[model samples]
Target chain A: MTTFVDIQDVTHVYARAEDGAPAVQNLNLTVREDEFAAIVGPSGCGKSTLMKLATGLQFPREGTVIVGGREVGAPVKLAGMAFQNPTMLPWRTTLDNILLPLEIVEPHRSRLRKHKAEYVAKAECLLAQVGLKGQGHKFPWQLSGGMQQRASLCRALIHEPKLLMLDEPFGALDTFTREELWCVMRDLHAAQKVTIILVTHDLREAAFLADRIFCMSARPGRIVAEREVEFPRPRDLEITYSAPFASLVQELRGHIAQARAAA
Target chain B: MTTKRHLHLAPWIFTLGFFLAWEIICRVLKVSTFVLPAPSTIAQAIWEYRNQLAFHAMHTLWMTLAGFGIAVAFGLLLGMALGASRLINAGTYPLLVGFNSIPKVAVVPILVFWFGVGWVPPVMTAFLISFFPIVVNVATGIATVEPEMEDVLRALGASKRDIVFKVGVPRAMPYFFGSLKVAITLAYVGSVIGEQNASNVGIGNLLTRASAAFEVPLVWAALVVLAVLGVVMYVITALIERSMTGWAQRSDMAAA
Candidate 1:
């Protein structure tokens, strides 16, 4: 498959940060079209910075970030994003929250009022896919954390963007819920065939969901290792219990430990 | 259930008990009408001069509402402008603070000078005193849009206008409504101050004339009327707030 996203030796520094240290330096990575890519690293290792760069929320200080074969100068309208916090607008119901992107990103923006029924139906379908079928009428506060996260996922995919950027989207969820979402995510990737870049600290989560995992080094983050999971499609949660899965997780954990120690 | 029912009745019971205590204290101490009129004396005065009191009360109410309406429009516009741009907020914030710090009562005379002794002074005073809170609250609401939430929109290539309308304005509704309660009350104080110093009508004017004539009960009656008006406006603003921004209030607070 052709590369859908390519970051070439990127470096970025936060303008207001007191110490003036670059958040990420020499950060080289690439993801193929429709590939599920997970980035694993130690804390403050610029995983979030990389996500920002890829989405064009922040420009790289010294490198090129190309998404869908075009250099990202402004926010890439073809990308959708979600973070650890669901951050749903409290006033809007789950259905409306999921439809928020359409109100901003067009041709939907221009057509939303006229085609709202069609859009609402699509949102309901997404909710059902994520195991939240009838809960769309409820507000964000009324929903549990897991349910909100599910709604958040539905929202990210609602615009049907080519690239989906997730920054530790399941970081705050409990273990059972987190694992349950891993299956949801697996099915979403299979069904949608959208390119997903998941930045996460959870080694097991990374190993379970991603087809290829890129492990990064400590401060001024750069890729230290890349491994491909040879597991077949339609992954089961039960496979996570196998010895091979544990060893893969252990290997990723060791890389993170080394990255942390080196800093 | 019993405790909840008691909580519901608490405000009315307390208010009645408070007036009862005042009436008892006045009767027991035989306080002079000039010194401190009894509740009964005030009530009698309210009945005796009901027409004059009603006229002045209506004047005060209209003046306060007119000024408050203007403040709402101007403050909302200014607040949105301030909230949307960091440059505008930084440029005007210090000046706003300095202006707000100056006693609005002190500005009434200047308003009177410019507009003459009439409705203009009272309306201007009400607008001046009440607008700061709305501006501050609305700006806070817009400025505090969670960075993560903003990222979701920005990633969609949403415009600055989209960010403001979609996230900023809605997020600021609770704050804006909250400020209305404060601004409405402040508007009353402002109009009353203006009425006392510059205008020939309103409760404030009635107060000045009655006190000068030693009609102490009439002064007390006017104060009671002002209090009732203030409470009515407050309740109205609060009800509107509840209807508009019920989403922001937690269930516990909403119950209260």
Candidate 2:
């Protein structure tokens, strides 16, 4: 498989006077073009920092971040991002919120005013894909948390980005809703074939969704282990209950425990 | 719906009840008209001098609006400038606070010297006094744009101008409207101060002349008119707030 994103010997420090936290140190990882990967570690172990570096939101102090074929000096425009919180603009309706990226990103930005109706239709299609049919007029606060999370996911993919970065997108959701969204994410990955990097702390989540899991050590965080999941595509929620899935989760848990102890 | 109507009418009922209570207390206590004129006398003075009172009140009303208009224009632009740059904010905020500290009443004399004591002083005074709230509110709105929101927008290649127009400005609308409810009243105070200290026209001038002549009833009448004018302007602002930024208000605020 071709390497899509490659991080090389990256070390980063946050604001010294304020946080004074060394977020990541000497981290190296590679995500292939066909991979669905998860970066899981203890809290404050710089999983988020790793994601930020990959997306070019935060530049590494000592190493290079390469996406596709270019070095990242600014925000990587080809990536789609969804965070733990939806952070939907309060003034906008769901449809307008979903259409926000198109209004900013170029090529689409240039064509948006000319083909306004087409874009509106496309946004509606996305809303429908997330099972929010005809509810586009509702504001963010009016919707349930799960619905809002779904809308956020729709927003992330609306630009048809090559790389999807999910920073615990389903972390706040209830267990059933979380599982439901896992299926939704699974279907999306199977259909779109986009490279996904999910940053999470849930061992079961990492074991179930990712084709490969990269376990990270404590801050200053570094990669300690990499485990390949042998699960087949279009994996259902049922696999989460099987013996193999439990063992996979245990193995990831073991690495994380070691990471916590080593810190 | 009926409850909503009752909610709306509660304040009006309270105001009328307050006036009635004042009238009864003054009559029962046989308060001197010189010190505390009864509400009936005040009402009679208002009716007897309706033409004069209306003329002065209208003069004050238009000047307040004019001054407030200048303030809105200046404040919004300055606020945008300040909000956009940290260097400008650091440089100007302390200066603004100092300016806001000085009494506009003291400035009226300086303004009169420059503008010859006509409509100019009142308008400028109102502009000066009412300008700060808008600047502070708008600047804060721009400054406080959520970091996550900015991060997402930046990831999507949104320009600073795009983020400001689409998110920052809109986020500040509730604040701008909140400030207007205060600034409008301050604008009126500035206009009256300008009139009392310098101008030849307006309710402030009328009140001054009435007091100098010991026309206590007329002074009281002017005071009543001024209060009503302030209330009317405040209600207008609240209405605009409801229409423009109803989304920003909490359910409790909407109910209140």
Candidate 3:
């Protein structure tokens, strides 16, 4: 498969207030088309920073990040993102929040007014896909944490971006809700075949969803280990209880533990 | 339904009780009405000079509203500019703080001297007094929107304008309204204070004239009118806030 996103040896550093060390150094990654990839690490391991770099929210200090065969210079509109908090605007209905990127990003921006009804239908459809069909008029605060995250995922997909970046998107939900959303997201990735770069601490989540998991060392984060899950397509919760899935999760956990100890 | 009915009459019952207690205490103690007239005396004075008080109140109300409108306009524009630019905030913050600390009421006399006995001085005073809260609140609101949310928007390839209009402004609404409630009251106070010093007609001027003649009851009557006006304005602003934030409030209630 062709690489959809390619990053050379990239380095990122935050200017320390009291002259502390760098944040991340010499990071390199490539996500192939329709690949479900996960970056797993301990807290503050720069996994989130890697997601930012991948999505073009930030540029590397020393290397290039190329998405779809072009170097990323500014923020990219060709990707969607969701985070732990969901962070949907309180004033807007769920449908409106989902349609936000379409109203803002080009090709659709100029056509939004002319096709508002159609766009709203699309947003509603995405909401329905995420099991939020009748709740489109509800505001962010009206929904539970899990429901909000589901809506957020719908919002991310509404623009039909080729890449979806999730930063701890399930972290705030309870175990049950999180597992449910994991299935929802898995079904989504299966149906759409969109390239996904999920940053998560849950090794089980990574093992269940990702085709490949990249474990990172602590900040200045570097990819310390890469593991490929040879699971077949259309994975379900049953796979999480299987022997191979447990072993893979345990291995990833070991890598994270080793990374934490080394840091 | 019970809560609704209770809410309606609760304040009135307390007010009536308060006035009754005050009237009884003064009358029973044989306290002179000169210092603090019985509520009935103040009410009577208000009835007697209804026309004069109304005219003066109109003056104060017009000045307050006009100044408040101007202050909101300038505050929003300046705040948007500053909020959109970190460099501007750094540059203008100290200057704003310096200007804010200059005892704005003390400058009222100078403003009157500059603009003379007209609406301009009071209007300017109201603007000066009300502008800061709006600017600070709006800027803070815009600044404090979740950074991760902003990153998400930016990643989705939203323009700067989109980011401001969709994320920054809507996020700032609660903060802006909070400041606006406070600003409206301050605007009224500013207009009244300015009128006291400079105007020929206004609630503030009425109070000044009554004080000059030592017509204490009449002064209290004008104060009562002013308080009522302030309350009416506050209630109206609150209604506006409720309407605008209905979605957010309902959502919060549901979540809670």
Candidate 4:
């Protein structure tokens, strides 16, 4: 498979000392096209910094980041992001919040005024896909935490970006809600076949959603290990309880433990 | 007097009771009309001079509004500039605070000196006094934009202007509205300060005119009208805030 993203020995430093440590040091990672990849590490492992670098939110102090045949000199126009917090604009209704990116990204942004109804329909469909059908009139505060997250997903996917970056989008949810979202994400990934890079701290979550996992070392983080999950498509939540899945999780846990020790 | 049927009327009931107590106290102490007129006396003054009061009140209202309107427009632009640029914000925030700290009333004389004892002094004073809160509030709202939200917008190749208009300005709405309420009230104070000394018109001038002539009941009457005007403007602002920034308030009000 052709490499969709190639990061070469990236390093980044914050100008503000109060922001704490330099985020990344000699970090290198690669993911092929159509790959469902997850990055897992302990807290403060610079996983967030990695996300920033990949998405072009930060220019690397050293090394290069290539995504979809372009250098990440600026934030890529063809990427969508959903963070841990829903971060829904409180002023906008659920549908309007989902429609926000369309009003920003070009081609879509230019055409939005002329094709308002069509875009609205697309947003409604995406919202419905995440189980928020007919709830678009409600504001962010009106929805529960789980419901807000689902809307967040819809907003991220609204423009149909080629690259989807999720930074623990389900981290705030309860176990049941988290599992439900994992299933939703799995189906979404399968259907869209767009490359996804999920940055999470949970190994089990990584195993469930990702086809490949990148384990990171803490404090000025770099990828320490890369492993592939040979799970069949359309895997149910039941698979997480299986012996094979347990062994897989245990294996990733060991890599994470070693990375933590090495740090 | 009962709380059950007319619970909404309790504030009015207490207000009437307060006026009755004041009248009784004035009668019991045999106070002169020049010292402290009773509510009944003020009411009589209001009736006798209704037309003059209305005219002056309108003058004060519009002058305050004109100054306040300028403040709102200028403050928003200045606040946006301060919020969007780290250099500007860092340089000006402390300076603005220091400027705001100088008692606004002190500047009224300077304004009068510059503009020469007319509507300009009050209008300029109101603008000067009222704009700070809006600047601070709008700047704060823009500066504190959530990092994740910025990332989301920036990832889509959004320029600084795009991110600001799409996220920063909309995010700043509640803050902008909050500052408007505070600014409008302060504008009234500024106008009154101007009218008290330099201007020949407005309710503030009327207060000066009546008090100087020792028409105490008329002074009391002007004060009542001023209070009513303040309440009316305040209610209008609160209503605008409710309609515009409902999302910010929904969590608290929803349960009620």
Q: How much does each candidate deviate from the true structure in C-alpha RMSD?
A: 1.0, 1.6, 2.0, 2.2
The candidate scoring highest on DockQ is 1
lDDT of 4 by residue, B59-113 (tens): 8998899999999999999999988999999998888889999887799888878
What is the DockQ of the complex in model 3? 0.79
- The residue-by-residue lDDT of candidate 1 on B107-139, one tens digit each, is 988997899999999999999999999999999
Cα distance off (Å), candidate 4, residue A225: 1.2
Q: In model 4, what lDDT does residue B218 have?
A: 85
TM-score versus the correct structure, for each prediction: 0.98, 0.97, 0.95, 0.95
The DockQ assigned to candidate 2 is: 0.77
Compared with the true structure, what per-residue lDDT tens digits does model 3 show for residues B1-256?
8977887899999989999999998898888878888999999999999999898899999999999999899988778777878999999999998888887779898997798988888889889989998898888888887888788888878766778888888777777888889999999989998888888888888888899999999999999998899999999998898788776565545333
List residue ranges in candidate 2 displaced over 4 A.
Answer: A16-21, B1-6
Q: Which residue window of length 10 is worst by lDDT in model 4 chain A?
A: A14-23
Note the residue pairs that clash in candidate 2. none
Instruction: Provide the TM-score of chain B versus the true chain B for each model in turn.
Output: 0.97, 0.95, 0.93, 0.90
Q: For all the predictions, what are the DockQ values?
A: 0.94, 0.77, 0.79, 0.88
- Lowest summed-lDDT stretch of 10 residues in model 1 chain B? B247-256
Candidate 2 RMSD to the correct structure:
1.6
Worst 10 residues of 3 chain A by lDDT: A14-23
Predicted complex 4: CAPRI docking category: high
Candidate 2 vs 3: which has more TM-score: 2
Q: Write the residue-wise lDDT of candidate 3 on A1-263 in tens digits.
A: 99998988999875542555556788888889999999999899888778888888777888889998899998878899989988898888888888888877789989999999999888887788888888998878778888999999998888888999999999988999999998999989987869999999888999988999999998889889988888997887998898878888788888999999998
Evaluate residue B111 in candidate 1 and report its C-alpha lDDT on the 0 to 100 scale: 93
Q: Cα lDDT of all candidates, in order?
A: 0.94, 0.89, 0.87, 0.90
